[model samples]
Target: MRISTITNWAYGVTVGLTLLSGGAFILSARSADHERQAVVESQALDELSERLTMAAEQTSEDARLFVMRGEDRHLQAFRGDENGERDREQALKSFKAAALLQQEMALIQEIEQDGEALDAIEERAVTAYTNGDQEGARQTLFGAEHERVQSDLLTSVRQLTDLIATRTNDALTDAKQWSDFWGAVAKSLLGLTAAVFLGVLYFVLRRRVAMPLMRMTGIVNRLARQDYAVEVLTDNRRDEIGEMNDAIQIFRDNGLERERLDAERRADQRTKDLILQMMHRLQACQRQEELAEVVSLFAPQIFPDFAGHLYVMNDSRTALSSIGSWREPRRAGPVLTSAECWALRRGRPHVSDAAAGDIPCQHLEHADEMGICVPLSAQGDTVGLLYFEGASDSQAIASARLYFELIAENIGLGVANLQLRDRLMGLAIRDGLTGLLNRRSLDDALNRIARDEQGDVIAMMVDIDHFKRFNDEFGHDAGDEVMRRVSAILSETVGEAGTVYRFGGEEFAILLEGGAEGSALDLAEKLRTLIAATPVTYHGRLLGAVTISLGAASTTADMPSADVLLRADAALLSAKAKGRNRAVADWVERSSTDRRRA
Candidate 1:
């Protein structure tokens, strides 16, 4: 049965048993009260009977004394015995006052008659003794009617006492029996109630609640693990467990759907991995040939039924050029792209039912032709386009579109990486401070000039005089400004024929190509004079004008090595020794003329 049904029954039975037990207890109590009342009545009757016997004995003793002495003293003494007389009168009153006084009416009447007969006998004996009829008084005393009445009264008292005692004992026994029976019934009821409670608890916990809960827990675990094969056990209950079972069944169904979802997740992950791998291979191409190889590798793998190509824009961005091209392996003929190439270059995909008219090329004019073109962007600039063609199918084209975007992104990154590498190389070769060819790039320029058709090259080394004092007095920041202005002047003055280099602290070097010795010396002196005329100011302070000492050397076919650079260094020292601001030139003996101070 359902647990509710069983619970209701158990509750009802328990209540009924409780009421029955209560009724039994009430009956037992009433029986005990009745028994107690009987005992009280019997005790009262016994008390009355004992008091009457004592009263009779008192009267008889008084009468015997009166008869033996024939003295009014004995009668007066009896009358004066107020304590005993009061007790006898109280006893008689008590006998009459009993609750069942009518039931002992015969005993009471017997006692009253005996009392009257004793009074008469005592009077007759007193009269006889006073008249000197001692024999007659003896006869009256011995044959007194009070004797028989008193004996009969005593017998009745004994019988009444016996009845009271017997009834009290019977009541006591009955009270004990009733108490024992009720006590046993109470114990039996308590034991049965305990057993019923325990049975209910065991049945509910082990079978109904606990066992079902355990099975439900197991079902939940299985559901969590995505194992949907486990069966759910549920009784046809209208309680909480029934609701839980239905919920679990719903959960199991949902879990099955979740399994399908998990499968779709794995499939999507595989598709993502495939697209990523293809894009990664596409991005690794540094040259058009590498890109062509990537296309060849992916075209047959990704689009086995269609031809594919990658069309890149030229450096001038005027037209599209084919870099990578592929045809299906089964098709033996050369695939011409004159038909779709124009449409592909227009930054859109094209589909041709039959490649005719606007679709160029007789070879590619087919009804089954479908093509896709996606723009490749690098740093927000369109670098190229990826072109692909395949049989017209929704799923195939959809998958290809996903791959197309990834491929475009990959090519974009490749182009960006190459451009950045070239730019950084240029920055490395140039000076950060003056935008001039730094000392490191001078060797490269020197080697290029040496190999060039320009037959002779002049090298000059220059230094700023007292540049450290200028920095200390005016602060290094203003000094740096001065240096920048000087470097800029040198760059503008030298123009294209010469390249300036910052060669260590306060020193500069220049290479002039195919220049005569006089021209080289004149250029050096002009640089020196111009720098000397230019004064630098810092915070309204006139730091004074500055000048540069320059040294010049020439390199012919004979002095092609970098050693010729030292001649310009030696001449610069000579100019510095002569004065602070000047220009000196190393004139080959043939070019020497006048060595005038500048």
Candidate 2:
């Protein structure tokens, strides 16, 4: 029940009991009042009876005195007694008005008749004594008839007094019984009221209100400290305590919700911080491989459930090759053609799952596996592809799409930067006219070759025969065309066996690794013959028959790279002195013996 209802019930019961007790007290008071009135009336009746007996005795004595003495004082005393008899008569009349019983009234009437007879006898005696009949008066005053009448009168008064005492004592007993009964009832009611009040105080205040309030105080304190794990007790009563419990339950639920949101917020902030750190590292990456390593290191930390690969477009822009991968991703191949990826073709991210109806990327090894392909592009050019797989659930992959795109964007820019830097470096070390490694690249290559003390290194120097004459005969542009054709021949002959450099102005150099000195001289002679065989076509004009002089040097155990180049140039000068279109070697005797055997 509601607290208010309980309190009202307690109050009502207390009031009712109090009223009952009060009514009982009122009844007891009335009983005591009746008992007091009965006692007063009984006393009055006894006093009146005693006075009547005295009056009768006084009248008899006064009459005898007058008869004996005949003095006027005795006569006056007799008259005074006669006058006092009226008071006795009035007392008897008062008794008649008191609702007396029939037996008691008859007794009182008999007494009244006897007193009148006695008084008449005294009056006659008094008259005779005054009229000179002393003997007669004396006899009448002390006569047997007067004595008998007086005796009857006194006897009747005594009987009336005993009757009044008996009646009054019975009335007092009845009044006392009523007063005691009502007093017991009042006491019982008062005791019941007190017991009921104590019960209400204990049950309602102590058990219902105080105990529950104490328990709720502890719960509220824990909630204030943000301890949401604490359990809330439920109450089903429709009372104030129940209402407070419900409010606390609501507060606990809100605290749990706030805790969950706070955890998510902190996780999201940490992810953002990781992304920011990754971007900063990406900016400092000097090579595509370094950038790949950075991504590989941080990707798992960012999304541990996902396995991914970083792919960069090849120089031909036709295929993407994996530069870095993490978590041993499935279905991402080492190489994929540009046309095989939808992300690359469409320039956006493509996601595929087991339930998705869309076509999957051709680059994926498994057709049914879930995956996402995010194209990495920078400044309107697609630079690479980022492929991811192995998300535990679709929602996880969906939530991770944004981070994937962010990683792809940064990787693309980094790869693009690395590619641009490589292209610029290439231009810096390449010959503009001949499309071969320039002098600076040759020096660097020769230095590297000199450091390798275990390998046999060969250096060949070649020059066109009469190159300045051709430039003076035809135009310089035709001369330029001839030199370009000869450089192409030298490069094609060397292939992967060595590097060819344009030393300067129709002078070229070739550096080979792991070739004998005789083999080097033979290779130089073959290059001199091919330059004479092939003619140059410049703007549809054929410049005929460009021959070249060649000189070659091979490294011994301790030959420096610079000394080898100088010896090869000296041999070229010796070939020019002997004849313009022949080959010479620093070990010329070994070359001749090997040539004779061929």
Candidate 3:
């Protein structure tokens, strides 16, 4: 109901109840007024009885005095004789007033009869006094007539007083009953009114307000606590409760969405963490076998039933070499054909799940071995392949393929890094112009050999004859070409027996193992002859032929120092000063050769 309508109804009820209670109060008041009138009448009747009794006593005394004295004076007093007549008149007036005040006919009749009896007694007593018979007057005054009058007077007054007392007591009883009845009725009406008010308040709050408010509060608390499972209760009446219910449903829906997002976020984090840990293991790999082991371990970590072989591509991509396979070696090696080479040369990731389709494999003689291949590429160049087998139940082939692509990417990066490190190290030690060991390598080699307690170690110093003239005549590029050619010749001649170093510009050094002065001098002569015979060509231009003068010494001498190598270099200078394109041996016997040169 509308509040205004409800309020109007309640007001009407209250006004009706008020009018009813007021009528009840008015009735009770009238009952009370009747009781008050009864009280006043009883009190007035008592006053009349008291006055009559006093007046009767006075009249009796006056009549007794007049009769006992037997005097006209006393008779006058009885009639209107000064003092006694006043008493008689007062008694008569009281008798008349008592007659008027009496409501009962029986009491009024008694009063009239008592008044006539008194009048007769008064006449008799007055006649006796007028005759001057004192004795007769006394007898008449105290006789039966006067006694009958007083007895009638007492009886009439007692009857009137008894009537007033009885009626007044009855009136008080009726008023008390009426008061208790009305009090009970008013109390009952008040209690009913109060009960109605409370009942209306309780009904209004519970159905229209309190219950819905409590439900809304409960929903709010549940939503605040992230409990999205609660259901909302609302009315069909299109009010705030309907909107609130809709809002709660939306909140639960949003909570479900957030929960889904949170789960996905955690899953992605786990994947990234696994990849990072896998990367850590990959970094520890030193050789191709170790890399294969890492890849194989990562396979099961990414997918179920993972078995695969890692194959590396050759420089020309015309060959596939299985670096590591996840099983034992077979009894025989399956021969790889040219078709497999062609597939590898195509240089793309290829998958084969079909029973009879061609897949590039050097060892695919068995039908049980089904697989797919993904290439490990670095900067668009295919470096290797990761081959995975299919499961017997179902192929996680698609997911496995994705994993292989990711794994291949990491593999490519790792291999590229390793190759780059090797190249950098090679560049650090190798001579840039000559492709031989630099001075640093020479120092390392000399130190190692000097520490050896072997049969012999020889050091040679070589100087190209007139290298400055060669550079000036043919330009620096041609000079560099000459140096490279000479370095190549020296390296080819020394083979694995010695280490060659480009010590500086126009100068080179060598550490020859297991060599005495004879081996050193023979090696130097070979280098000199080779350079004299060969000429370097640069940019299709013929550069002049070059020759190197050589000096040789041995570690066989006691406590030989690197300074002895310096003596060999000094000897090379002497040889170059004498002539070019010749070997000058600086052996123990070189002192005699040195004296001759001097």
Candidate 4:
């Protein structure tokens, strides 16, 4: 039951017990009053009986004295006693009225009759004595009839006194018994009320209310400290404590929810931190390989359960090829056409799983594998792809999507920047007219090749014969076309064997690593023959028979890179001095002469 109901019941019961106790006390008080009244009535009856006896005796004595002495005083005394009989009669009437029992009333009646008879005899005797018949008075006062009446009155008085005494004693005993019984009842009622009050206090206040409150206090304390693990009891009760327990349970549930949100917040912050770190490393990457390495290293830490690959579009913008991959449980091929990937075709991120009804990407090895493809784009151009796989569940994939997109965005920008830098570097080092390494790059290449001591290095210098005459005959434009065609021929003839550089307006240089003097002479002669046979066409005009003079030099153990280019230039001048459209080697002529002389 409710606590208020229990308290009200206890209060009501206590009030009822108090009222009963009060009633018992009132009854006991009434019984005590009746006992006192009984004592007073008993004393009154005894006094009346004694007064009746004295009146009878006094009349007898007074009548006898008047008869014997015959004096006036004696006569007056006799008359006084005779006249007081009326007072005695009144006392008998009072006693009869006050009597409680029939037997007591009957005794009062007998006493009244006896007193009246005695008074009649005395009165007759007193009249005779007054008329000078003393004998008659004496006989009346002391006669057998008078004496019998007086004796009867005295006996009746004695019986009445004894009966009053016995009745008063019985009344006193009964009154005492009644008072005692009610007093015991009052005491018992009071005792019973006290026991009930104590029981209510112990059971309701201490056991039911206080004990549960104490337990709830502990539970609330734990909940205050954010401990949601504590158990909440007392929910089954129908009391105030049960209501409090329910409230505590709600608090615990909220605390648990708050804890879950806090954990997610921390995890999200950690993931963001990892993403920021990965972005910093990406920005620091100097090459595509370095960027790939950074992505490979950070991707696993960012999404540990996911396996992914980084793909960069080829230079032709026709396809994408994998540059790096990490934690790939199911590997795909290294290359894929741009048309094969939905993300590339759609220019957005695409997701596929078992339940996804869309067609899978052609690059994926397993058609049923769950994955997401985030196209890496920057400035509206899709530069690469960031593909992820091995999402264990839908929740995991959903959680990873944001981070994956973040990674793709940063990596795309990074790769774009790298590609731009490479293009700028190429533009800076390449010759615009002939697409060969310019003079500045040629100097750098010569230094690098000469620094390597592995094998002989060859340098060749070629000059177009009468190149100024062609420009003077046709035009500067045609002359420019002639130079372009010659550069192309040099590049094609020296393919994979050496590097070509446009040294000046009409002069070209070649550096071949790991080549001997004899091979250099052979290569120089081939270049001379090809240039003499090939014709240049410009704007539908064919310029015929363009030839060149070539000089070749090979590195000795002690030859410096600067001397190698100087000797080749000297040999080219000698070739021009002998005749145009010819090839010469700086060391081959001396070697031929020594062999002939030996």
lDDT of 1 by residue, 1-598 (tens): 6677788988988887777777777777776787787678677767777887777677667656777776787777666654345455677677677644354666667667766666667667766777888777777766746577667767876775676577677777888688778867866777787777788788866777888999899889988887898887656877767878899998887888888789767766765676567678756666556756776676565555667656665656655566666774221123334333544346444444344334532324343455555666777676665666666676766756666676567766665565566457658887767677788898787777656646678889999998998889888877887788789889988998688998877788998877788888888888988888887777788878888998888876666546557888888898899886888877743245443321
Off by over 4 Å in 1: 1-37, 69-77, 80-89, 101-103, 123-134, 205-207, 214-231, 234-238, 264-598
For each candidate in the order shown, give its overall lDDT on alpha carbons: 0.71, 0.86, 0.69, 0.85
TM-scores of the models, in the order given: 0.40, 0.64, 0.44, 0.65
Full candidate order by lDDT, most accurate first: 2, 4, 1, 3
Model 4: weakest 10-residue lDDT segment is 78-87
Return whichever of 2 and 4 wins on lDDT: 2
Over 4 Å off, model 3: 1-282, 285-348, 352-371, 378-382, 387-403, 447-456, 588-598
Clashing pairs in 1: 353-367
Candidate 3: deviation at residue 122, Å? Answer: 99
Give the distance in Å from residue 470's predicted Cα in candidate 4 to where it truly belongs.
18
- TM-score quality measure for candidate 3: 0.44
Q: Candidate 2: worst 10 consecutive residues by lDDT?
A: 81-90
Model 2 ranges with Cα > 4 A deviation: 1-200, 236-243, 315-319, 331-342, 355-370, 390-399, 429-439, 447-558, 568-598
Write down the RMSD of candidate 2 (Cα, Å).
8.2
**TM-score top scorer:** 4
Badly placed stretches (over 4 Å) of model 4 are 1-9, 12-16, 32-107, 110-200, 223-231, 234-247, 250-254, 316-318, 329-335, 356-362, 365-369, 390-396, 430-440, 448-557, 565-598
